[model samples]
Target chain A: SAVISQKPSRDICQRGTSLTIQCQVDSQVTMMFWYRQQPGQSLTLIATANQGSEATYESGFVIDKFPISRPNLTFSTLTVSNMSPEDSSIYLCSVEDRGEKLPHEQYFGPGTRLTVT
Target chain B: DQQVKQNSPSLSVQEGRISILNCDYTNSMFDYFLWYKKYPAEGPTFLISISSIKDKNEDGRFTVFLNKSAKHLSLHIVPSQPGDSAVYFCSVSGSARQLTFGSGTQLTVLP
Candidate 1:
């Protein structure tokens, strides 16, 4: 299990502005992921952040919209650019334990709730 | 398209009773399934998981049942508690290599 913390627990932003959410893990992780969740809806995978190289984004999502940065093994940031009312949702970060023997070992951060006005 | 689906939008269960939440996946390539619980203004916490090879897995008060043939899985909580009142989400991962989530089911454990 990992303890992950995200900054800006909740924020209200202007429609054209952007918000960058930071995620820090207690331990170094191999794979970090970003997610977007609407109210009372399931989470949607936005991208995967590795230490180096570009992040792998999912379909219907683009880097220009949600750029990710993973400078080290224990930290990552996700920026939601050009926010709109539709982008008002919870942004969460998840870490996948690489060294674990099990195939499905992952943990989530507290999440950043962004409400665009 | 939505690969994972939790049909129920919300469920109410009596405290100390059994609460069963079901999920279904459309992709046959999915080899791993997981359950997560979430509270307001928080991330979804991983609860339990089951491999495609197993039919059932249990830990303490939580039990996960998977049926590969029907492409269905379920989480059962025995003697549900008030603290368990939260939104539960079901997730699946397959050749896509990324986890796909389903619409969560809000479980209200009423005393």
Candidate 2:
């Protein structure tokens, strides 16, 4: 298991502003992902942050609206661009560690709670 | 459309009793299923999982059962404790390994 942490655990921002959330993993991992959990909704994956390359965005999510960057294997950032009240949700980062027993198991960070007013 | 579903938004159980949470999926390609527990202000923690080839997997007080034909899954916790009160999410993974999560079921283990 890996220890994951996110910066700016919670934040309040006005609409039309942008906020960047950082996710740091204790160890280098191969697969890093960003997920958003809207109020009363399921966790939806936003993108797969590729180290040293552009991220792969999910359906209904675009790079312009939610840009992602992964400069290294242990660090990544997700910035919500031109935020709106509808974008208020909890953002989480997760890493995949191919353990001997559980290859697909993923460890997550203590999400960032964002409120867009 | 939601590929995975948790019809029950919440469940309450008495302490020292059994707690069961159910989930269903529309995707037959899902090969792995997992259960995650989440507390307020914290990330979801991996609790248990089961493979499509197996019908059941158990870890201590937690047990996960999968039914391929019915496209249904369930998690059972024995001797439920107040500490188990939290939001439980059912997630599934396909060949790509990207997880598809359910809407989550809030379990309240009353003491």
Which model scores highest in TM-score? 2
Question: On residues A1-117, what C-alpha lDDT tens digit does candidate 2 reach at each position?
Answer: 999999989999999999999999999997899999999989999999878778999999999999998888899999999999999999999998777785378899999999999
Clashes of 1: 0
User: In model 1, which residue pairs have backbone atoms overlapping below 3 Å?
Assistant: none
lDDT score at residue A39, model 2, on the 0-100 scale: 99
List residue ranges in candidate 2 displaced over 4 A: none
The list of candidate 1 runs beyond 4 A from truth reads none
Residue range B52-100, candidate 2, lDDT tens digits: 9999999999999999999999999998999999999999999989999
Report the Cα lDDT for residue A57, model 1: 90
